[model samples]
Target: MLRFEGKVALVTAGAQGIGEAVARRIAAEGGSVVVTDLQEDRIKALAAELGDALAVRLDVTVRDEVDAAVAAAVERFGRLDVLVNNAGGCIVSTVPEDTSDSEWHRQLDLTLVGAARCIQASLPHLVQTRGNVVTISSVNGLAAFGNLEYAAAKAGQIAMTQNFAARYGGMGVRFNVVAPGTINTPNWDNQPDTLEKFKALYPLGRVGRPEDIAAAVAFLASDDASWITGHTLPVEGGVLTGPGLLDLTPTGPFRKDY
Candidate 1:
């Protein structure tokens, strides 16, 4: 049951949502987890709940904070076995005509650059331990979405996965991406329309839960996925397979429009 027994894991943005779920899963699987997040109170509380975890305040975009967090992980756990770069999230943007330079840059910073910083901070430790990295990318990266900056950032993240895999696979380190589709996180609560749209588009008729992405993360971080690297695994419930009918047209009572 303890697939990651005796491993040392550092998860970025481990305070809530998919990141939190991944951290809990790692702990449950017998790994010593360092839950790093910018939200001190949330991570502190989470660390308390997950008795085997250590909480650290880390702003992945900040180099000093990134270094300190990594150092803390190594200091507390002796060695780092895995680095889960699960920190990035949606950075809202506007249409091409309205999009500002700062907004675009901010999206790239939060989604792509943040992941890059985490990887940079953890690379040496990962190389030392011959560990693995599981980055939480998005299906939006693989396909076109209206959110230009967010999609571009995610695509950059996926590219980074491949580059890292090629660069470090010989060093006994592995890198991979888990691209989830329309995950129902706290952000979904703020935008009810997104949830409805995702369910409409998804063949499974429901949006993804945090654990769905967490499960993929756990597998990728474990030795069980030893042969997998540089791969973008779509944990998207077949969203990439084909388009689902938004409305089947008069086939059901709920079918009101075309």
Candidate 2:
């Protein structure tokens, strides 16, 4: 459980949702965490709650801020053992036809390029510690789901992971990704019924939680997954395997209590 007892991790957008979950999980496992987000108050509050955590204001889209945040993490922790690129989301445009050029660029810059910047900034320390990177991508990147621009950016993260793994694996740094499906986060506050709608799609009979993704991320970042790199772990409750066909059957496949 204390896989990161002596490690230090830097997480982006760690104020809420999956990012916060990841920071909490890492810290729970004894890692010193640097939590960063645009919301300074929330991140500072989270840092206070996390005891050994440090809060840094970061806007991933800004190169200067990204560099400064990385420097601050090293200055505070001496070394960065993990970098969780969790600061990303889709814009209002859900479909390719409706997505404007600016929207496309913005999505790619924030979700894809922002991650690249952090990786670049943290690689030196990761290489020094022989650490790893766990990027939070989405299932939309692997399948033809909605949110075209966001999906494209997420897919880019996967490609970057593979390339970085190949390029840096020999140097002791690893790169991997976790693709989550229909997570029930604050983003769905406007659609209270969304969880019910997504439940029928997953074989597990429910959508995902932030903790679900956090668990996978912790595993990938831990030494337990030291040999695993350039891989995409789909912590999607079997939604990517296929639809919940058995749920539609009259007897529920085995007819057990159906």
Candidate 3:
């Protein structure tokens, strides 16, 4: 389905992993994509590979860069129909109490404030086109996922999206979030065994894939979700349903084969 035909989308952190997956999905669905990231080489290669895509070296943490990226999108595509805020990540590694103010500032600046910057820069064009914004949040934002700073920043994204949705609903510009669980992204490359261990913790018996998130973001960004605004769609693998005990496993009590 070409849900994004004749439309344009700007995705932050579109170098690889979830961001790259989202960009590919949008392009596959017939949208012109603006792929922005600090990885100049990767983004450039990806944009070239995608044909109708633009590569913008955007550091979402910087306001000037964010504004410039948005402007570039409009200039290149003639309009911006969607803004995918995919730049944020878990940066603070310190424990909650041990986390320094500087660390907290950096975390929030990158995740929370960064998304706001993109939205602020894209708002005018979105308003003109009656467009939408899809933010990639995390399940950590909804529950106690251990990383305090990261969780807080993710939660802030949810709150910010809700407010934006409410404020801009009348203008026909929607705002929503895709809160995903442990996706097998490059972030887990260092800990090869970690994703394996994480699978047992999920009720679905497997960890998430970047394509899983791309699908959710696509749904929320498309006109298919026209009435969906200010909502956080948890695309987790049913991990949020309850404690994912071993009972759900094939050999466990909850399993049955026909």
Candidate 4:
């Protein structure tokens, strides 16, 4: 259970949802976690709950803030073992035509550039520790599931992960991504019915929980995945494989018996 013992992990957007779950998982498994987010109060509360965690206010879009947060983590933990690029979301306008130039820039900046900023800032420390990176991408990035801007940024994360993995492989720094499906989080708080509708899209007959993605992240960041690099593990309850076509036709596709 203590796979991350003596390790220090920094998780961005760790105030809630998937980021919070990842922080909690790492801490629970004996890792020193630095929970970073724009929500100072929630992050501090989470750090308190984790007991050994350090809470840092970080807005990934800001380069200075990202650098400062990484510096603080190293200052507190002595070295950084894992960096989780978890802060990102889609804008309200999912339509490509409806998305303005500013909206496209905003989504790319927050979701893609933001992660790159954190990685650049953490690379020096990661190299020192020969650590790894676990980036939080989405199934939308791998497929056209809507949210065009956000999906573009998520896809960029995968490319970035591969590049980093190749560039830093000699240094013993691995890079990987977790592309999650329809996870039941506060992002769906206002769309409960929509979430219910999405359940049928997944072959598992249910949407994912935060812990589901967190488990994949933990494995990628742990030594158990030491030989793995430049890989993207889809943690989407069979959604990435294919939609549940049979669920749409319960009559068994016009079987003779029927």
For every candidate in turn, the CA RMSD to the true structure comes to: 4.5, 5.6, 5.5, 5.5
Q: Candidate 2: lDDT of 139? A: 87
Candidate lDDT (C-alpha), each: 0.84, 0.89, 0.90, 0.89
TM-score of 4: 0.93
Candidate 4, 1-258: lDDT as tens digits: 999899999999999899999999999999999999999999999999998899999999999999999999999889999999999987546456777888899999999999999999999999999999999999878976656678899999999999999999999999999999888888779878778877777888998999998999999999999999999999988876755533433223211110
Question: lDDT per residue, candidate 3, 170-199, as tens digits?
Answer: 999999999998888887788667677677
Better of 1 and 4 by lDDT: 4
Return the lDDT, model 1, position 47.
90
Residue pairs whose backbone atoms clash in candidate 4: none
Clashing pairs in 2: none
Total backbone clashes of model 2? 0
Q: Candidate 2 lDDT, tens digit per residue, 18-118?
A: 99999999999999999999999999999999999999999999999999999999998899999999989986444456677888888899999999999
TM-scores for candidates 1 onward, in order: 0.92, 0.93, 0.94, 0.93
Runs in model 1 lying further than 4 Å from the true structure: 245-258
Name the TM-score of candidate 2.
0.93
Best by TM-score: 3
Using lDDT as the measure, name the better of candidate 1 and candidate 2.
Answer: 2
lDDT by residue for model 1 over 1-258, one digit each (tens)?
Answer: 799888999999988889999999988998889999989999999999888889999888788898899999999889999989888766664555687888888888888888888888888888988998889988778865446567788899999999999999999999999998777777667777646755766778888999999999999999899999999999987767746533323332112210
Off-target runs (Cα >4 Å) in candidate 3 are 245-258
Task: Count clashes in each candidate, considering only residues at least 3 apart in sequence or on different chains.
Answer: 0, 0, 0, 0
